[model samples]
Target: MTEALGTRTITAAVLVIGDEILSGRTKDKNVGHIAERLTEIGVDLREVRVVPDVEEEIVAALNGLRHRYTYVFTTGGIGPTHDDITADSVAKAFGVSIDVDPRARAMLLEYIAEKDLNEARLRMARIPAGADLIVNEVSKAPGFKIGNVIVMAGVPRIMHAMLEAVLPTLDTGPKMLSETILANAKEGDIAGPLREIAERFPGVSIGSYPFLSETGPNTNLVVRSRDPELLAKAAREVADMVAARQPAA
Candidate 1:
C-alpha cells in the first residue's frame, strides 16, 4: 500500500528475475541499491520479489506488481540469450506484442558492429510495444519502460545506469525524515514504552532494531516522520524513554 503523509505517497516495487539468483549462484545487489536510490528521491519501495527465469512466473509477478504499486522495477532476464525473456514476458503481461525495435538496434550499434550483431545479440534489441527505452550508458543494450513496469539489466553497473536514466522521469513525494536513538537496552526493555510513544504520534513511524553490542544485546530505536517537527518530538520522547530505562550510575 502507498504510505500517506501530507501528500500522496509514490510507491514502487522491485521484481528480481533470474534462475541464478533463485539457485543462490548469483547474490542480488540491485534491491538494496534501488531501495536507497528511490528513498533518496522520496519514493517509497513497498515490496520486493525474486522470481526465476520462467516466463509465466515473471508475467504473473509483473502483472501483480504493476497493478499494486505506482511503479515496478524489474532487474535481469533482458540479456542476449534464450533465457533473457523479460521483454517478452513484460509484453505478455501488458497484452502487447514484442519485436526488435530499430531504436534499440541503433543503440546497440553504437557499441556492437552491424555484421557481428548475431541472432543472440539481436535479442537485446527486442522491446515491448508502446514502451520507452531506458538508455544504458555502460552497455548499449537498452532497458525499457512499459506502463508502470521498468525492465532493466541484471548486471549491477548496467542496472544502476538504467535506474539513473529513469529516475528523472518518475514522480516523487516528500522525503521521509528519520532519527535514530541508541537505546542501550534490550528490545523487551523498551517495547512497552515504545508502543505508547508510537500510539501518541500517529504520523510518526517507530522501529526497534536489536543488535548485539560489546556489553550484550541492545536496541536501536529509529523514529521516522515526514514532518521535521513531528520527528523531533517523537525522537525526544524516545530518548526520554531510553534514559528512563537506563541504569543509574
Candidate 2:
C-alpha cells in the first residue's frame, strides 16, 4: 500500500520465517511483540508475511521488505536445528559471506560447556559479514542485524529481548498518538456520521469499532494522528457526532 502523502512515516515489515507457523503447529507470538515495541518507538508496522523454512522464499521476502520499508524484522528459524535457515537465507539475501563470528561464539560458550559445543550448536554462531549482533539475554545465542534487516530467534522470549536491544538503534519519526471515544450508539448507526467527520479531518485518522456488552452493540471512535492538537480536535468532533446520534434518555 502507498503511504499517505506529506507524512513522515517510519515503516517496517515483519517476515515470519518458519514452516511450523504456516502449518498451524506453532502459533505466532513475535509479530505482535515486535509490532508493539516498534510502535512504542515510533515505527509503523506496514506489512507482515509468514514464509516456510525455504531459503529461496526467505531470501525473496527479505529482499522485498528491506528495500520497501525502513526496517525488516524476521522471527524464527535461527536456532541450531537444520530447519533454522534464517541466518543462511539472510546471508544469501545480501550476497555476503557467512561464518562463525568470534563474538557470537564467545557468548554461546558462556552458557554451553566446552565439551557440549557441537557443530549443531556452533551453527548458531554463524553470522553474516559486516553485521552487528542483536543480544539475546534469555539465551546466550545472539541474533544478527545486516543493513535494515534484523534476524531474530523464533522463541517469543528471545525475540522480545532482541527487539529491546535493537530499539534504541532505530531512527524514528513522529509518534502516533490516539484518542478513543466510546459511543453508546451501534457502529452501523454511527458509520455515516463518522465518515463525514473523517473527510473533514484530512490529517487525522478516524476509525469506528463495534463491540457487544450487556447493553448490546456499541461503537468506539478512535482518532489517531501525530499532532496532539489535531488529534484532540478530531476526537472532539467524533464525540459530538456520537452524541448527536445517541438516543435520548
Candidate 3:
C-alpha cells in the first residue's frame, strides 16, 4: 500500500457523463458533494467535466482526467439502460476487457433470486477486469474501481452511499483546515482583492461565497490549507482586507 506523502498534494477530478445532465433533465449535485468530501479527506478537486453519453467523448474525458489527477470519479452512465456506456468506455480507455465479475454476481445473487438475475440486470455486473468493487448498500449492484477511476451511480443518494463505502479504502493525505470571515460586502467588490490574497498564500485555497438576505449583502471568505498555521494566517489577512473595505458606521 502506498502511503500519502507528508505535505504532498493530492488532487482529484470528476467526470459527469450523461445525456440527461447535458440536456438539463437532471441537475448534478455529485460534483459539489464529492468536492467537499474530498477536501475533508485531504484531496483537492482540481477539475470537473460534464460529457454526454457518447463513447468517444467518455473515453477521451476519462483518459485525460485519470492521468492528470490522483483520482478520477465518474458518475452517471453505469446503469443497465441502452445509453449506459461508461463501463465500456472506461475499459477502452485502459485497454482492458469488460466482463462480469463473479464477486459482483454473488453479491447480486444475495438480493435477487437466481432465476431473476437475467441478462439485463447482469449488465450491471459487467465490470472492467482487475477492477475492485465499490459496494452499493441501497441496491446490490456494485460500482467499480479501475486503476484510479471510480465509476459510481448517477442518483445522488446512491452515489453518496457508494462514496461512503469507497472512501475508507483510499489513502488520504492531511485533512485541510479552513477558517472563514464573514463581511458585509458584495462578491464583486472583494473578488479582485481576494484573488490577490489567494495568490499571496500559495498554499491556501481562498474562496468567496456570497449570500443575500434581509440582513444585507454578505460574503464569506474561506481560506483552506493543509497547514493549520497557514490557514489561520491567511484567514486573518482576509478578515483585515474585508474590514478595510467595509463602510464605517
Candidate 4:
C-alpha cells in the first residue's frame, strides 16, 4: 500500500546488510551517522536491523521496513564481489528485473576504461529496473532509489556522501526540539514524578538516562517535542520537579 506524503512526523528505518557486520568483523559507523543526519532533517529513524549477506534475509527485511516507514536506507552489499548481493536482493524484493543499466555503466566508464570493464566490475552496474540513481561523490559507483528504499555503500565515507546527496530530496517534518535537566537524584528516586510528568504531557517524550557521577547517582531527564512551546512547558515542569526533589544547600 502506497502512503500519501506531505504529512508531519516523517519516519525512516536503516537496514545494515553485511556478513562482516553481523559477525562483528566490521564495526558499524553508518547507523549513528545516518541517525544523527535524519534527526537534523526532522526525519525520525524509528528502527535499525543488521542482516547478513543472505538474499532472503535482505529481501524480507527490505520489504518489511519499506512498508512500515517513510523511507528505508540500506548500507553494504552492492559491490563487485559474489557476496555483494544487495542489488539482486532488492530487485527480488521489489519484483523488478535486474540488469546492467546503461546509465550506471556510463557512470562507471568515466572511471574505468572499456577494456577493463570486466564482468566482475560490471556487477556494480547491475541496477534494479525503474530505480533512480543516487550519485556517489567519493566513488563513481552510484547508489539507487527504488520505491522508498535508498541503497548506498557500506563504507563510512561513501555512505556519508551518498546520504548527503539523497537527504535533500526526501520529505521532512518539523525538527524535534529537546531540553535536558540534570536530576541530582537517582533514577529510582525520580521514577514516580517522571512518570507523572510524562503522563501529563502526552505530546512530549521524556527519556531518563541514569549515570554515576563523582557526586553519586544522577539521572539526565531529556524532554523532546516537535512543538517548541510544548517542549518548553514540559521542560520547565520537569526542572521544577527535579528542583523540589533536591535537598536545600
Against the true structure, whose TM-score is highest? 1
* Candidate 2, RMSD to the unseen true structure: 2.1
List pairs with backbone clashes in candidate 3. Answer: none
Considering summed lDDT, which 10 consecutive residues are worst modelled in model 3?
1-10
Clash tally, candidates in order: 0, 1, 0, 0
User: What does candidate 4's lDDT look like per residue over 1-249, in tens digits?
Assistant: 112233577899999999998789999999999999999998999999999999999999999999999999999998999999999999999999999999999989888899999999999999999999998878789999999999999999999989999999999988877899999889999999899999998888999999989989899999988878888999999999998977889
Predictions: Cα RMSD each: 1.6, 2.1, 3.3, 3.0
Candidate 1 has its poorest 10 consecutive residues by lDDT at 1-10
lDDT of 3 by residue, 1-249 (tens): 122235567778999998988899888899999999998888778899999999999999998899998999999988877888999999999999998889999989988899998888888889999999999988878999989999999989889999999998887778777887887788888888888888888877888888887888878878877777778888998999988987787
Best-matching candidate per lDDT: 4
Model 4 RMSD to the real structure? 3.0
Question: Which order, best to worst by lDDT?
Answer: 4, 1, 2, 3
lDDT of 1 by residue, 61-144 (tens): 988889999999999999988888889999999999989999999999999998999999999999999999999999889999
The lDDT values for all models are: 0.92, 0.88, 0.87, 0.93
- Candidate 1 backbone clash number: 0
Work out the TM-score per prediction: 0.95, 0.94, 0.89, 0.93
Cα lDDT tens digits for candidate 2, 1-249: 223345678999999998889899999988888878777878999999999999999999899989999999999998999888899999999999999999999999999998999999999999999999988899889998999998888888888889889889889877888898998887887788889888888888888888887878887778988887888899998888777766787
Off by over 4 Å in 4: 1-7, 214-216
